[model samples]
Target: MTSVSLVAPGDAPLTLPVAAAPAPARVPTARRYLMCEPRHFAVEYRINPWMDPEQPVDVELAVRQWRELKGVYEALGHRVDVVEPAPGLPDMVFAANSGTVVGGRVLGSRFRAPQRAPEAEHFRRWFEANGYPGVVMPERINEAEGDFTWTGRYLLAGTGFRTDPAAHAEAQEALGVPVVSLRLVDPRYYHLDTALFVLAEDLVAYYPQAFSPGSREVLAGLFPDAVLADERDAACLGLNAVSDGRNVVLPLEARGLAAEVERRGFTAVPVDISELRKSGGGPKCCTLEIRD
Candidate 1:
């Protein structure tokens, strides 16, 4: 047999073991989000306790902060889609209240307060125009993601505030998911997203004082290892967070909550949206997850 040269002619020839190529790195799927620009965002009307028409809102600052928030998501390799902001709808920037998108269907919200009533039509039109699989107009008063969120298994619905108890049944039928109703007793935690947040599969972070005793028990049973937020952070809307399993986007002032999240193996991304908070919204309020 002729000897084969493993090197160039006149160069030293050596034998070497052939190695197998390493497998390609697995890339994680990017999460999709829906956001609205704070063009006409201001405290024009008093809806939630956080909103005060007398308190002036720096419109320009709010816009800049909102843009920064959108940039945060884009930098993390997540897709961000925008919905056109309506001129007179000051609260339109809080897109979370628009509706709940799950399994390709959009269950539109019906506002309990007339100040936000006009927002329902705009959101419904957007979903219909986008050709969602299905768009259900809720008959009962529901604040969409403001009071409803998915925990990978069940949809936790909040009531005794902006959302009506009757809407729980409507959400179940409309979204085709099991609904767990939780009562919000405190005015500050009027929206469910403000008091409770689902961080990952079977993991959550919440403020116990926001919920009634019964609701607190329910949450404890459902999420035993829930990260409890202290009164300071909770007051700063620390529980109002958006998590994509590994990364959690929350308020910059929520240092305590961020620490808790870091301990649980999640990267805490703090974004300052204090301008938006004046209107009763934070990072989560500005983001609406598109499950489809």
Candidate 2:
């Protein structure tokens, strides 16, 4: 009564099996790092007067102050990654500021100051020992100490002061993540973090003068809840604090910033880093927190 016939399609079509959605990647957890005892940049102003008063830093005190700061991070339940001091490399002592940690990889950076070149080696060894992806030293480009920032989702590469455009591009390419290159017109505004810090994905702390008008507009649009830190507060370690995912470690001078941080329900812990600031660095500059 009823006959059913199956017929192939008139035209042959090539088809591939649909790939199952990749398992959602596990978000890396935030882990803190402690650098080796502080070492001086060997500037004459820092050196002893009898020997060389012009040294830019006082090594003995810097080392002690560094350790104190390191202890604070430890108290926050973050793991510490330490590097031993190198003999010939003076700047190697400031390892945290030299490189950017992207995901599981640590991209060794090239420095603007020729004297800081030796700093890369120590970072290489540290990354290797910790079972992190191999360190990639960006070739054909040089990045300065203030060139980079690992702001959770994206890496910010500041161009002009210590990092050139080429260096920023290389870091972005090697990391395989998006990078935003900010044009820094003012030499004093060396790093993006110097004038801007991401307090939350939608919130930021910034100084208007630090960014160009275009960048400022972009930042304001992206972070509508941004709390603008007064210039005086910014100069006083306000912008140099760290947000441990949820809470923040504030600098003592950032009184205004701290008040806002607390209002937002973040635990704002004020740290005294007068010693580090003397060298033009602060809390954020002292530690590199690698999120795993």
Candidate 3:
């Protein structure tokens, strides 16, 4: 497997301030991936074959997909973080947002939706195994892992959808991180990531339709150079792109968005995640990046 460099013009080399820092390299261009061995959601929402189904998915096939994803990551020399699937909470296995790592501490999340409650158990085990300190969960409030977005100084939590208003307040008060609450009302846009993602310290890509006036203002304030994705492409999960400081992984259908990402001096790799999307997930939904 040949490794592709993501370095682009005007991109500064990354450096760690301290000696004992985790890997400072951003998302590797050679690394592209998806999650295959997913647990099934309840039968109630089984309309999408990629989602919870009236029948269970073939376990063997799921395992094969997992191996494929792992193989791609491993081939690219990127370590794969695997979370054991939790029974009953079918979506629990989508481990990316189980928690957020900041200042070398892992804060496990409390999901707002009941169907995903089982995620806490799986996340707890993963955190413990990874040796992270000081995990916190809101006592009475419901907060989804998808709701929280963290930068060095601030953490913004989205309210509405699965995460509640009360949880947003709790995240700020309990976590000791300055929290800004963004409201998302559209049912299609279930999480903040569905419409917005921070590309860099000063850059973000998002769709305005999913954001409240206040939320857009907050984004504009925090990232002055934020770019808006076209609605057609945004519907195809264009705004959900992930950046590792070098390359971005975007939905395969978003060609225009991919060009824009490349225009910004980042390499854009289109990946097929149709299987994961059937279950209301994407590339970001599949894996957790443990920075340390």
TM-score of each: 0.89, 0.79, 0.76
Candidate with maximal lDDT: 1
Report the lDDT of model 3 for residue 184: 83
10 residues in a row with least lDDT, candidate 3: 27-36
Per-residue lDDT value at 193 in model 2: 61
Largest TM-score belongs to which candidate?
Answer: 1
lDDT of 2 at 22: 42
In candidate 1, what are the lDDT values of residues 133-164, reduced to their tens digit?
36888888999999998998999999988999
Error of 1 at 176 (Å): 1.1
Give per-residue lDDT, candidate 2, residue 197: 70
Q: What's model 1's overall lDDT?
A: 0.89
Q: lDDT: which is higher, 2 or 3?
A: 2
Query: lDDT by residue for model 3 over 1-292, one digit each (tens)?
Result: 2233455589965543444433233443333222325644333454222355555445445445445555545654666766666566666546655766555556667765566666776676666766664666656445344667665467767766766777767676655678778888666677777777766655678887788888888878887777778888878876665665556767789888888777676777677665556566666666555544
Instruction: Rank by lDDT, highest first.
Output: 1, 2, 3
Error of 1 at 94 (Å): 0.6
Residue pairs whose backbone atoms clash in candidate 3: 27-244
Candidate 1 pairs with clashing backbones = none
Ranking by TM-score: 1, 2, 3
